[model samples]
Target: MSTFGDIFGAMRQVILTQARLDQLDVRMTRMAGDIDGLADGISLLRDRISRLEGIIEGAAMAASRQQRRIEE
Candidate 1:
C-alpha cells in the first residue's frame, strides 16, 4: 500500500546506504595495505637493530681483552 513517492524515497535511501558501504570497503582495503607496509618496515628495523647489537657486543669483548692485556 505504498505510494510512488514512498517507493522512490526508499529506493534512494537504499542507494545512498550502498554507496556509503562501498566507500568504507575501499578505505578498509587501503588501510590493510598500509598496515602490511608498516609491518614490513618494522621487521626490517628489527633486523638492523639485531645486527648492530651483535657488532656492539663484539667490540665490547675486544675492548675487555685489550684491558686485560694492559693489566697483565
Candidate 2:
C-alpha cells in the first residue's frame, strides 16, 4: 500500500535512528569507563586522607604528652 517515496523515506528514517543509537552506545560506554576511573581515584584519595588523619592525631597526642612532661 505504501508508495515508493514513502517506503524510501521510512527506510532512511530507520537508518538514521540506528546510526544515532550506535553513536549514543559508544558515548555511554566511554562515560561508564570514565565514571569507574573517577570512583577509583576518589577511593584512593579517601584512603590517603584517612592515613594523614591518623598521623595528625598521633602527633597531637605526642605533643600533648610532651607538654605535660615539661609542666611536671
Candidate 3:
C-alpha cells in the first residue's frame, strides 16, 4: 500500500521528467533549424566552388594554348 507522501513524490518526479522532455524537444527543434541553415550555406559554397573551378579550367586552357604557340 502506497502512502500519500509516496504517491506525491512519484507524481513530482513524473512532472519533472515531463518538463525535461519538453525542454529537449525545444532544443531539438532549434538544432534542426540550425542544421537546415548550415545545409543552405554548404550548397552556396559548392556552387561558388564550381564556378571558380570553371574559371580556373578556362585560364589553364588559355595558358596551354599560349605555351604551344610560343613553342612553335
Query: lDDT of all predictions, in order shown?
Result: 0.99, 0.99, 0.99
Candidate 3 overall lDDT versus native: 0.99
Badly placed stretches (over 4 Å) of model 3 are: none
**Span of 10 residues, lowest total lDDT, candidate 3:** 1-10
Give the distance in Å from residue 18's predicted Cα in candidate 1 to where it truly belongs.
0.5
User: Residue 14 of candidate 3: its Cα lDDT?
Assistant: 100
Q: Model 2 — which ten-residue stretch has the worst lDDT? A: 1-10
Alpha-carbon runs more than 4 Å astray in model 1: none
Clashes of 2: 0
TM-scores for every candidate against the unseen true structure = 0.90, 0.92, 0.94
Across residues 30-65, which tens digit of lDDT does each residue of candidate 2 receive? 999999999999999999999999999999999999
What is the Å distance of residue 46 in model 1 from its true position? 0.4
lDDT of 1 by residue, 3-70 (tens): 98899999999999999999999999999999999999999999999999999999999999999999
Each candidate: RMSD: 1.7, 1.7, 1.5
Regions more than 4 Å wrong, model 2:
none
- Clash count for each candidate, listed in order shown: 0, 0, 0
**Candidate 3 has what TM-score?**
0.94
For model 1, what is the alpha-carbon lDDT of residue 22?
100
